[model samples]
Target: MLKKSPVSRLENLWDDSEAVGMSEPEKLLYRSNLLGSDKRVTNYGGGNTSAKVVERDPLTGDEVEVLWVKGSGGDIGTIRMDGFATLYMDKLEALKGLYRGPEHEDEMVGYLPHCTFNLNTRAASIDTPLHAFVPRRHVDHVHPDAIIAIAASANSKELTQEIFGDEIGWLPWKRPGYELGLWLEKFCRKNPEAKGVVLESHGLFTWADEAKVCYETTLRIINRAIAWFEEKTADTAAFGGEKHPSLPPEERRRIAAALMPAIRGMISEDQHKVGHFDDQNAVLEFVGSHQMEALAALGTSCPDHFLRTKIRPLVVDFDPASPDIADTLDRLRGMVESYRVDYAAYYDRCRHDDSPAMRDPNAVVYLVPGVGMITFAKDKPTARISGEFYVNAINVMRGASAVSEYRGLPEQEAFDIEYWLLEEAKLQRMPAPKSLAGRVAIVTGGAGGIGSATAERYLREGACVVLADIDAEALSATRENLAGRFGPDVVRAVEVNVTSEEAVAAAYADMAVEFGGVDIVVSNAGIASSAPVEDTTLELWNRNMSILSTGYFLVAREAFRMLKAQGIGGSMVFVASKNGLAASPGASAYCTAKASEIHLARCLALEGAPEGIRVNVVNPDAVLRGSRIWQGDWLDQRASTYGTDKEGLEEMYRQRSLLKRSVLPEDIAEACYFFAADTSAKSTGNIINVDAGNVQAFTR
Candidate 1:
């Protein structure tokens, strides 16, 4: 059932005299009003409004000037001619053919030149092609709330026909720009008499031979639908309930600012705004009830609305009987995840083709319990409009559900729409590069195979290195050996135990202040202690854990805080042994500690992703040559136990790998560089194996 609002008097502000003998300023004002009257009617810059006029060109004869189609970032309510990019009719129409023969729509949009004056601003509105295709002198496209409400409803097509049966034609949602333009071209060709087009989950397109006709038609359609919907779901008690108390405007603004960073990459700030559904009696009654989870599964009214309102709302339990809000939040998050999985399955079933789905949910409507609904948006206008639409949709869906289960787009079909080419194109934009460059990296246990080789590779790639070891003599000697070849600043010597957090922190802090900031931190410092699971003493376990696990956390935490505060995205690499992935004979403590570090890195990767910080771990197999762990009696004891000579033991280890080659520290360094450089901008929360393909014993 649809709810319709009472029809008000038709307000036509512009008269024939005012329209026919319009001065430039008067015409601009009229155009602004026609475009800006309805917030839900359009997105920030999603739609374009234009008027045609004859103007003189200096070099060309009898030019048809299109008043600046709204340039990017210019709001319609206050937009002026300066906001519009004036283009010659022929020049604008020629763009239709610019992207020919198997070109991606996004690539076409990207190549479109930024408007002449606002070079630094966003490119022109994406609806330029559709507007240009219309022969009408005045054109407008809007994502009107009323139109979208019907479009999102299950009976949308039927509802639309009932409301505007003779005047309107419906167009299925398609990626904006090229695909949409092509669709409209075919549609208009089929129905030349059609005055307007309704794009499902998108908006409405209305054009008229005259500006007043276009404006009047838009209002009439919306008003008619509103009237019909209100009559269908006219329950006087639908909104009866206690209203949630309001928060201070400043407090609301602060909360919005806090949430902005989390969603910035997905939605622009200008497109986001905070709105309160406090006064909505329906919302209050719904939130006060206990069906929060079911209420949240309903999809957003439109896809673009996700940028304004998140795909679902956050249902905060504010009851005094609730034990913990944090726990409640955890449960809600679990619910969100559950809904996401179900939604994905639904999309997969409905999809006719294969395409990856977006991992992030687009809209979230919160059930604030006693606090009412709080909606998030990329910008304020979007937020307000999205909130209103969501509330309205909720009312309608509930009404329909009272009679029967409310159905949504099939799982696969929804997935198809969500993973559509246009949406994926938005993800293809290149992000900024990592900030750490021209800095040095030092890993302790330098003479040890992994440590020494990592240091060597860093030096070759232009990083000054410091190889620190407990053995002062070995440390000094390695420094002397590498200094002549890689330069003195490229390598330094120090003696320190990684077990001491104070020592590790001081060392990294000094290096940061000395080198402008520790751009990269390789916590590749650890001792391999072998003791059978039963024989592993608590004391031995604690020592190994303190040195390997705790030490890495201390070092990484300091580096991350400094790098993040410095506003630079840093890279941290951890070298956990293969023992971290699978159990090794007589190495319980070592395996546990290494496993802990691996988990730590995974957590850091998630937390650091938004900060442009990337964290990854490289698990390398045993590299016996030059490793302190292999030197002295350690290798001989292991070899004797395995009933093989040291050489044979080393060969066996190399043969165990899928590549049939020994894993080297340099191999690990290559994996480190992938996460550290711009080449892997989209790579995070990944663990790469430098173990020459040890498939059986792999890390998750």
Candidate 2:
């Protein structure tokens, strides 16, 4: 059971007496962080908190009560004082006099900005009135999963009485708005002794004279509710089966790989890009359960979840034993189209005159009987977040079913929350997304310096990146580092030997399963070898040819197939060297291999043009600083050939270029991004030389 008192980390922020020197907002900051830090309490930006304080107005020099509530787009985990929007209490509460019901949803949004005590303060969260209407000096609200489980049950009122013994008030489902706030205020007047109110199919609220008391009350109520759940669900046989069943992992992977591409092709609207794919073990177990239909049909366990996961997930009928990929894809396409049609009809039936226009009707989650759950969204992060929320919803639904029949709000109520004007206003306030926000990119040789730099650049442009390399240690390290910045959902590491066709094919198949399909392929995996023609052995030449020439062919062959399956125009970039064009002495093996790779790109470009796939090359020279090719004997030979130290030799190469600047991996990355991104949509079968203005290496 959760502790009845707040987990006070305030001591970490201050010594015994140091807290006395803190300001009211500063105290709330520490308290807010504690509340937001728990995922069970909040997910991403799901909850809000506030404290009542008296401060003098700058103009009037008179005391005023200001409500410091968490602002929109603020995550409590790392929120600062600026995250709290200060509202004049009198000004905000007076709006209750203008109770216009749910129809004034748009008008309520318009009036919020004008209520801010300072014009520069961030917009308060939509639940601001819920905090303002309460009589307590401090309020804390969170969508605890355990609390939601009970509140969404068919016997919610009974459960509330059992858990709180009439100490808490229960309100029926109402679309959140001015009227909901008005109703809460009346409940407080009628039940003055109640510690909190459980909002049906919404969340929980607790209040007290002190911040700590309110917070502790919230946790205590949640903990008691969780205790009731555990006692009721103690019989494992009643819940049935494994929480996660062992359905051959290989078969699950195969099914996801085959189904995602078809789903992407159907949902994608962008000409050159498609959505990302993600799956979870919890979701897989839920779909495999005998009670899958019953639990899912209950709709969203919480109204806020409708914004992420749709009102109900479209369960795609898939058989793991199906033998034909093409046949299976055709069947899934028909099902998905029907899902869209049904969604349109639902919207038409439920919408009011003030309702927002319906959004694209693509199903977010695909529950395959044998294949687990597949989530699709414009980008990997959103897909991953959606998958996570679904997993939690499944848990809540199951928990509720164990206690009583799970009951979510009606479909019309869910529709109201999904298309609420307040959410639209918040979305419109965001900046434009990056160019390749929904695209998936794969970089071969990705643990290497140039490849890693290229992967980083694609992620910066908002593309989901898969780093494929033969070096396991480097691949793992690079993946962990990049995941720290862009999140694990958008960054993945795969071990691939480009020389082996099996390895290359498996890499693309996994990419299809992990991210639907590929929109960009960077072929940079190769080994460098240098020898005079007379001394060049067949073994050395063949080694270079296998890695550089054959590897490029294998990557392109698989990439083109997946892109064609997706029916989306895509980009393939081969990383060649300037030495292919400008012959260097004792570099026959390297130059010959590069030449073959470069020409292969042009040939593939010619064949792919009819399908709108563009193939290009980036030729870079003397990127020696971080390159593995310039180590040991190779470095010695290059320095000996130039008649100078390694440092001086670098300067000589820099001067050889017309621009007189040393080329770096980032310079090559920029050229690759241009070819892969929509910026160079009209260019194809072209070579971009990143040798700092190499005159001889320039494309003809």
Candidate 3:
């Protein structure tokens, strides 16, 4: 049996302040958050909510009924007052006479803006009419996986009665629009006893006069469906095809590693349109199932999933227990080609003159037996979202399969949703993406001042960054900080002791496995040795030289090798020092090592030009902030040597520069960005000084 009421967890969170101060719209928003908080109820930005209330018009001060519906860009989980687009009820209801059916989709869409209650300019969801016509104070619509499983199944009406006992209403699949709303309103009026309505292969809608009642009603119905599913699937186990010997963990990782790079390469349209890959256990289990090919061909459980995952997933045949890598690779290539061909044919068959040119035909989901289902997208987050939805859809399919047989909306229905202008409008509302949208970058010493700053810049430009550093503590802190700004998965951290050749190679290899291949490499790992040539010990000189010179060599070598293998020319920026070009007193070891690094970049530039690779250097000086070299003993000694306080020394350096400005880590980071980005496409073997106009270090 279903839980008669919601768990009441959110009610505990609704403290006295919120409960006392809450208005009708806020109450509706609170319920939206409750529904969105549960993934089973709504995936990322997939549902809508609304409430009808009487409010005074801002200009007229006359009380009027209004429908405050969730706006286009508003996520239910994080909606606020501004996220609701309030429409005058009388104005919206008048549109009912204007809408006939699917033929009026464009007209209805065009007329919605004219009905705005306030001067609000936000675009409301297409389902606004569906909420407006319900005639209930509060209405909640969600794409719960459990409900979708039942609704998409062949025996949906039979199961609906068995589960809800006619307490819920059923609306056969109608494309959501003015027509859906009209149908739903008439059905609710005729069957006043119905607590909720299930839209076949669409989603569920539950409503009542009170906010809590509407929310609880939704929970009860969804839980009822879930209870039935659990009862029905209690004895069923995952299908894993014919049993083969399982590979060891290391072997599995190796297979995944090899498969990801090839998958990324195969799906990439070009260097500029490179995509990312991701997978999970559930995805692997589904892909490895004996009936995967048959079930997946039935199409997605719902139309909403078609936006992220195509109508049906592409299947690739492979046996992990087999030792023939060559054969597996050949099979993968052929399957990919076949998928692309089939996708083009599907597009040709369904495309109308008004339809947009076909999107890239690459299969978002690649089902590899014994390995897993790999999802591809232009970025990591999108790829991850695709993989998640695919897993959820598979679960729904399995549930349906267990009960009877899995069935879903036809391919044309999916195409209708996929190509609908209303659906595409949501995507068009987003700002243009950054230039490095699908690229990956790596920054050595990424926990330090310049490295961390550069990583942040790259992320802002829409590139995934790998922060490689030897300091575990600092690395964790930097990763956490950056992850908070962009996303948890955007900035990946790898522990790398630059002086260790093995560590350097492993770091690059790991990045290749994580994000396919590297596009930009910022070689910026080094230490300072400030001693008079006579006083400099062999240990001190060797220590500085090892990190400054040898570390650069190891990192650059591996990056070059990987870039060459991938056959994609890339960029590399070395963080050399101004002292390398302009000798400084008592800095022989540091200057010599930096000078060596600069010359190495020049040599690599010459070697890589033919292959379209570019190597450059940024020379920065007197950047003390966020510099570990300026802390502890170094700070005290430098201050003593300058015969002043730390601030005094900083001022001295600031005044010494021709520009009379203190050099900063961010200044160096900008130069690195120039080299790593397309801005320096025509230039290489060049050194850009970031020392606030250092005349002595000038190079032309």
Full-model lDDT, candidate 1: 0.61
List runs of model 1 lying over 4 Å from the truth: 1-29, 40-46, 65-67, 95-103, 114-122, 235-279, 285-295, 317-364, 376-700
lDDT, candidate 3, 472-578, per-residue tens: 99999999999999987677999999999889877876776567677789998878867778988999899888999999999999888767655567899999999
Q: How well is each residue in 504-525 modelled by candidate 2, as lDDT tens digits?
A: 9899888888888888999998
TM-score of 2: 0.92
In model 3, which runs have C-alpha deviations exceeding 4 angstroms? 1-21, 240-252, 270-279, 323-333, 509-516, 633-647
Q: How does residue 328 of candidate 2 score in lDDT?
A: 71
| TM-scores of all candidate predictions against the true structure | 0.48, 0.92, 0.92
For 1-700, candidate 1 gives per-residue lDDT tens digits of 1123333433444567657887543574576655565443444444567666566665555554644466655666667656775555666666666767434665666654632222324456566667666766777776665667666656666666777885788876565676677777677778778878887656688877666777777777766765665676565333233233334444433333222222222222122212233336556566555444464555554555444444456555445233344455445445545645754565556554546554444334555554456554422334445566566555544443432234333334445556766556555654532232244465767766677777776666656566766777777777787887876544666676776766765565444322323446677877777656787799989988997898888878876765564444657788887778877777788889999999999999999888878888888777676667777656775676567998898788888778889866677767766666557777776788777778756754
The clash number for model 3 is 0
lDDT score of residue 328 within candidate 1: 50
Evaluated against the true structure, the overall lDDT of model 3 is 0.80
> Can you give the lDDT of residue 457 in candidate 1?
69
Residue 412 alpha-carbon offset, candidate 1, angstroms: 6.4
